[model samples]
Target: MTHVVGEACIGCKYTDCVALCPVECFHEGPNFLVINPDVCIDCGVCVAECPVEAIFDEKDLPEAQREYVELNLRLAQSWPLITGSKEPMPEADAWAEKSSKREYLVEMV
Candidate 1:
């Protein structure tokens, strides 16, 4: 079991979760974060740290966000691991309440 980072993280990219991740399972994309399933211990520590409420347990992912299970796995393979907290995207606040930001997710840096 692993956690998945969903669309709510697309534009926000909040790093609070990173600081609390004991395994450094989070990967950083240009505008998003993904949890590496292979590395995640499924402790669920990152879930609450996310301001956008984007992190979900693999088994608990919303039906609409179910695709994120695979999305997180695929992206984590290419993105760099994030082990420390950092500032969120400049427009994080503006993008926080928006629900359909999947289209804004940047796969590359």
Candidate 2:
């Protein structure tokens, strides 16, 4: 299983999680960050570093954010790994607020 990024991280896109990630499982996406489940060591460092409290253990994820479990993996596969500091994607705030109503919350995996 992998940790998931929830809605709170939408506009924030804090890289603290990325910095603390031991395996660098976090990847940059078009509008948000994704976690590579295959690469995640489950060290839980990223989870703690997230300022918005968007990260969650797969098994402990709330139902509202359950889609993020798959979203993380799918987005990570196609998106590139962003090393060093990352800038938050533009319009992340708008996306985050609407993600709950998005037709495709999680890309098909």
Q: What TM-score, over all chains together, does every model reach?
A: 0.97, 0.77
Tens-digit per-residue lDDT, 59-107, candidate 2:
9888877877777877888888866566555765564455454343433
TM-score, structure 1 vs. true: 0.97
**Which residue runs of candidate 2 sit more than 4 Å off their true CA positions?**
87-109
Model 1 local distance difference test score: 0.91
Alpha-carbon error at 30 in model 1, in Å? 0.6
* Clashing pairs in model 1, backbone N/Cα/C closer than 3 A: none
Pairs clashing in candidate 2?
none
**Consecutive 10-residue window with the lowest summed lDDT within model 1:** 100-109
